[model samples]
Target: MADDRRLEVLSAIVTDYVRTREPVGSRALVERYRLGVSPATIRNDMAALEDEGYIHQPHTSAGRVPTEKGYRLFVDEVARIRPLSAPERAAISALLTGAVDLEQVVLRTVRVLAQLTGQLAVVEYPSLRLTSLRHLELVALAPARLLMVIITDTGRVEQRTITLMGDRPDPGDDGAHGVIDPVALERLKIRLNASLVGRRADDVAPALAGLAEQAPSDERALLAAVTGELIAALRPDAEERIAVAGTANLARATPDFTTMGPLLDAIEEQVVLLRLLSGDPADASGMRVSIGSENHEDALAEASVVTAGYGPGVGDAVAHLGIIGPTRMDYPATMAAVRAVARYLSRFLAGPQD
Candidate 1:
């Protein structure tokens, strides 16, 4: 019973401190919350919490504020991370559903997240290597020019324009004009799909290595150009990309940070943000929270990050999204916003594309 009451006092301190950005005294806690106990008893509980390293008094005469330990305990024990309200869910769904492609979806998602949490938001784009090819379309724009459309299972689409080169004109074309035969273009499309559809992005190039050789002599040059572009599109060294929003929100919490320069610089470095978001594995609730000193970067020492992975299903995270703010943040609401947005994004990616 004593332990439980102490936890309650700690929770109340965390809440009041986060809201007011001020040290909470036992008297204020008693008045603000009905602890069902006398002021002296609350003071004793506060003393116990402080001794245990969960909270501390910054100034000898001032009231108490929660330490990082206290915040972690509050997040793990006392905070109830509830789902977003029906209207909130509807709003997110409506916003995400309107996106036309993968790029738009990511941009819109980061904006929505930043708005919901009032904090800096980061979203890692789905890794191409993890996605399978869903469809491939080839259109003959002209005899020497073709449009190649590649669609992935995660609804990512890439288009490339290939210019045919070599000594041969298409089968039905006069030597004067570099026109491709319609019948041959259609046949190449069918063959390319047969050889490459459903393969992982990393395997695309290898699967198409001998494809040009298999085509008829007159069509080999066109096939080779198309395959080369496809291979380049799915190169292994392709840099991973991330989207970020709400830097102004960080500026609002300037008082909480020791120095804002390093933090701001780190945010601009995509590689740093990606490593931070993906470093920690999530907990049972599909959430990962890094508080204060737990963060790897010196720039983030005074900040907290809440992240959740999103993908087609459980244990299949293709990428992650999260928020960064001062350690004195509202953990419950931030966790809920991250979880909710991640769920919506997962459903969006798993669904069929237009």
Candidate 2:
């Protein structure tokens, strides 16, 4: 019973401090919250909480503020995540409307999340190796050049320009450019669609090689060029990239954080950003919070990260999205906003049926 009362006092202290941005005294707590206790009892609870490292007196003042431990406890045991209202959900879905492709969807998602959370938002693109091919378009440009468009089921599009290394074709498209044989292009398209349309990008060279071996001699060179470019697009990204928005919000909230410069720099570094944003449902909470020193990067020691993974289906994460802000943030509201935005983004990327 005593422990529960202490927890209630701790929760009240955290709430008041987060709201008023001031240290909470026992007198303030009794006045602001219905603790059902006298000032003496509240002060005793505060002393016990401070002794347990949950709350601390900043400068010999009687008023106390929650420590990181206190905030973690509040999140884990006390605070209830506020649900996104119907109007808020409608607004997020509306923001992502008319995005023609997955990349556009992700871009708009970051923007919406930034606006919603009022913090720096970052999103990782899904891995190309994990997505199956949806469509491949090979267009002959000029006599010796071909344009390759690779589309994935995840709505990512990759384009590459390849110059056919060995093929020599006459300029025949109305004197505009030498067009590869229409018959050859169509046959290659059929072969590629059959071999690639529903397959993951892994071990793709062998499949394309088999096609090249069986190609008619006249189309062999063009097929090889097309195959090579497609393979390049399929290779895993050497450096993972992320889209970021609302950096201006960081500067605006700088006063709340002591490590603002390093935090900003960390946000800009691809490797650092990836390390911070990457989370799995197996290892992280549904809506995870990495607060203060919980962030592995030293530069972000005074910052907090809120992240959730979104994918093509339930619980299978294809990508991660989240916000970064000071540890003194309103945790429940931010978590709700991140989760809500992620749900809409997953629907957008999951295609019409999702």
- Per-model C-alpha lDDT, please? 0.86, 0.80
Worst 10 residues of 2 by lDDT: 169-178
Give the per-residue lDDT of model 2 (tens digit) for 1-354: 248899899889988988887889988988889989899999999989999999999877669988888888887788777998888788788888887877788888899888888889998887677778889888877667778888877787777888865435433322222346666777788888898788887857778888876776666667767876777777776445589999998898876776577777777788888778874232344678887788877888878888988878788667788999887788888988988887887787787771
For candidate 1, the 10 contiguous residues with the lowest summed lDDT are 170-179
Model 2 misplaced stretches (Cα beyond 4 Å): 166-182, 203-206, 279-285
Q: For each candidate, what TM-score against the reference?
A: 0.85, 0.88
Report, for all candidates in order, the number of backbone clashes.
1, 0
Show the colliding residue pairs in model 1.
143-180
Write the residue-wise lDDT of candidate 1 on 1-354 in tens digits: 238899899989999999999999988998899899999999999999999999999998899999999988998889889788888788798889778788999999999999999999999988777778888998988767889998887877778888766465556543333456677778888888888888987788777777754667656666777878887777866677899999999999999998999999998988889887887778998889998888888999899999999997667888899999999999988999999999889988877645
Cα error, candidate 1, residue 74 (Å): 2.1
Model 1 lDDT, residue 7, Cα: 88
lDDT, model 1, position 81: 95
lDDT at 185 for candidate 2?
Answer: 75
